[model samples]
Target: MSSSQFQLIKEARLKNNCPECYSNDSLELTIKQKLSETQFYKSITNEIVSDINCLNCELQIFPVRWTDDIEQVVNYHKRGLNLKTKSVALKPISWGIITFFTVIIIATILFATGVLVL
Candidate 1:
């Protein structure tokens, strides 16, 4: 891992405990790095997860990452350091539903027109 990747993982591991896990007996953090390429050059991505187990309950939490004028990730966990009520965007599910229907419709049309025989 690169220095930046190590730093990100270290930062995530040192973060404070989850508010909901106040009564938990154990908590830990695991970090991972993924490399990718953009239009310019290669970049390192970081992902951190807090593993907590307490009172017969287990959970994982992640921190928020954002840049100027851009929001990368959103916090939607049930309990955490900054607990609050907020809007949760379920856009991915909507897109999946639309895409499923569109694909089926297109495939049906193609089959009916004998353009696609399988």
Candidate 2:
């Protein structure tokens, strides 16, 4: 069974005040992708989660704690953020199926032309 994993998609540090610790330039925002494979199948699903942490107090900050000034600053930075997303890659099982079909067709062709012994 494949276990679910959280991969860091994007990480950015903001020079903003931490509401919890009241520290300046200690906030960090991170976006993570949680990937999980379906049981008894090769299908995989991905979900996104965002987190804000304060390095000074080691506290997790919430959006509700953001002041108006902080909101404006976050919005300004948000406009500059270029979030690039990538499509999921094809699994090895799909290539294996294609190869199996190709080999079967080749074997059939060889047998029909008497090129394959027995």
Candidate 3:
């Protein structure tokens, strides 16, 4: 059976106050990605999720729960993270598709020219 996997893309701790406990230097931000694959199927990926956790209050704070002050702090910290990325890699399924088309075109041409005996 085919299975799916998850990966951590970016994780940064934001030193902001917890809305519940009112403590500083207790918030953490995590960004994750999910990759999925199956038998005879194309691989799918590039799913992302962002979450914020508070150490002081042990609560998961959603974006709607953030106040103005929290938003500013979060944005400032996000700007500093500054991660660089490169080009994406094609999956095995893509290569297989390209090869299949090439072979079909070649076979068609050869048969039309009487070069292929089939």
Candidate 4:
């Protein structure tokens, strides 16, 4: 089975106050991108997500509770982010599987045409 995970792309400390704790200089913002992995290949996807947490309150701050200023700062940081390009990388096992299938197909064709006998 394939698995998907979020890999950290960027982390920044924000000066905004946490709505829950009302503390400044404790808010942290983090951005992450999705990665999918399987036995055959690993892929980086374009899906991106962000999260905010307060160090003082040790709590996660959801977007519903975000103040206007906090939202603006988050947007600014997002605009400046340099995200990774999406790509896929095949494993050695996958290459072996492809080679095996190719060889089998070619041999079958040759036998049908009488080029390969017995």
TM-score of 1: 0.25
Reference-based TM-score of each model = 0.25, 0.54, 0.64, 0.89
Best by lDDT: 4
Q: What TM-score, to 2 decimals, does candidate 2 have? A: 0.54
Q: Write the per-residue lDDT of candidate 1 for residues 1-118, one digit (tens) a residue.
A: 2222222232122233344554332334433333444333444443333332222235543233222211111132212333122222334555688789999999999999999999
Per-residue lDDT of 3-103 in model 4, one digit per residue for the tens?
99999989999998899989999999999999999999999999999999999999999999999999999999989888889999999999999999999
TM-score comparison, 1 vs 4, better candidate: 4
How much lDDT does candidate 2 score? 0.72
Which residue runs does candidate 3 get wrong by more than 4 Å?
1-6, 33-48, 82-97
* Candidate 2 lDDT tens digits, 1-118: 6667667767778888788878988888886666665433343344566678999999888778877876776666555555545344556776787899999999999999999968
Name the 10 consecutive residues with the lowest summed lDDT in model 3.
Answer: 80-89
Q: Global CA lDDT of candidate 1, please?
A: 0.40
When 1 and 3 are scored with TM-score, the better candidate is 3
- Candidate with best TM-score: 4
- Candidate 2: clashing residue pairs, number: 0
Tally clashes: model 4: 0
